[model samples]
Target: MIPEDILFEYNAKIKAFDKDEKIFSENEIARNYYQVLKGAVKMSNFNDDGKEFIQGIFYKEQSFGEPPLFINVPYPANAITLSDSEILILPKERLLDLLTKHHDIHLKITENLAKRLYYKAIIASEISGQEPMHRILRFFDYLKNDVHELTSNSSFKIPYTRQQIADVLGLRVETVIRSIKNLEKKGEVKIISRKVYR
Candidate 1:
């Protein structure tokens, strides 16, 4: 929640991770806060059968894996680099100390965590439904609302690939591709080449 400069001033270390690199595995003890400086990261967990269940995909300037650091528990999911990315690592104790001094930073962290909880509630219902198309559309709407300027019917581009969408939505990649095509035909969204806009 603190600015980049403040993090660098307080027990921060810069690390570069390659795509597909495991930043931390499931059940690992969370001792640090991570802020992505560039590229992307995905947090996920695998089922007993090895099927991946994506928690979320984070892009530049986004932070991940905070709950365990606060609660003194292990990480519930794995954090992996989705692209070659630089991360600023802040130790848990140092971060907690910093938070006590910065009221605005503490408030920002609370606000962001609340937003994530709200998103999770929305997706919980989306995935439990039988309609893959609606689930996909709802997720698209969520993404647009999250980081873009939205008007009544303004269009925005989706940042993730079809496979990424499927993993997050608990659908097959083929299902995502097919459902997107259908959405395009229905004039609900438009896809040009591989870029998806809704």
Candidate 2:
């Protein structure tokens, strides 16, 4: 559970977004650190050809935006709402001040950074060697580890569309569709009304 003091401190600054709305854009000045209180956010950026590629996804209860602040750079990616969402925003300076005063918060931040680094390593490895279908499968497996029984028939919801999944997996949209079709053919997974079931 999140610490109540953190919620109390930033409650007044919280913001909401509707699905597909931009929460923040790439190259925007890094001024706030955000904690996802509901729904999901996709972090993405455009390639030279102006095609967007997803960098990561943040689910409910996760925090983001501090890395760019710590690095003293504008935001590296665009943050977009995957669904109607609520996020708590604290000014970067206030967050830094909290870190300075709270040892536990500092440790939590360090652990978050470490987990991000580990995930980055996995993504890099997949980019270098894994096939797109395998990469997507691995990503689903990773999500399942965090969220038990993640299929549509289960309790939790998958908040991404097929095109969004394609972008996040670094595959052409057609490739993503075909991969899912193949998985269906193999009896490995099923897509029903745009929801994935395993």
Candidate 3:
């Protein structure tokens, strides 16, 4: 992600949002570059049956909704604040200019996009063909290894709730709870005071 000072130098502005506030809607024109300054945001969409499918959850210092800027398309999902949050936003033109002048930052952005693409590909495959346990493990592994940079076999506390995990993995919350218990019984994960750790 771009440094705070650099973003500010390029005229980035920080805006506050209440919990569950929509930062932008699906199909909205991509006119700004957004980075979470505090709290979190989830990029998601609802199905015809009103079931929510979460595209991704971004925490502090992470950027979201950038693919549209690169592709010249509208946002594919809605971005909503998960809590009272502050977000730094830069105009699309200014962001482009900032990237043009900062090669390292541009490369970093490209790398981040590539990581997201890889995650999407893996998740797509898992959802289409894998069992529930396999999907859950793969999802946790990606978040631990790729996103959190945790070493294999180390205990990593899951940051998301069961409902959030179910939404992200296209499963029901009850299924997620059952799977977590199964995983615990198999020693794949530990349930410590109702929190899951892997």
Ranking by TM-score: 3, 1, 2
**TM of each candidate vs. truth:** 0.94, 0.82, 0.97
TM-score of 1: 0.94
Clashes of each: 0, 0, 0
**Candidate 1 lDDT trough over 10 residues, lowest sum:** 146-155
Q: Is candidate 1 or candidate 3 better by lDDT?
A: 3
Clashing pairs in 2: none
lDDT score at residue 124, model 1, on the 0-100 scale: 91
CA displacement after TM-score superposition, residue 171 of candidate 3 (Å): 0.6
* Better model by TM-score: candidate 1 vs candidate 3: 3
Against the correct fold, how does model 3 do in TM-score?
0.97
For residue 56, model 1's alpha carbon misses the true position, in angstroms, by 0.5
Between candidates 1 and 2, name the one with more favorable lDDT: 1
Per-residue lDDT over 1-198 for candidate 3, one digit per residue giving the tens place of the 0 to 100 score: 899999999999999999999999999999999999999999999999999999999999999999999789999999999999999999999999999999999999999999899999999999999999989999999999988889997899998899999999999999999999999999999999999998
| RMSD of every prediction | 1.5, 3.3, 0.9
Candidates 1 and 2 compared by TM-score, better number: 1
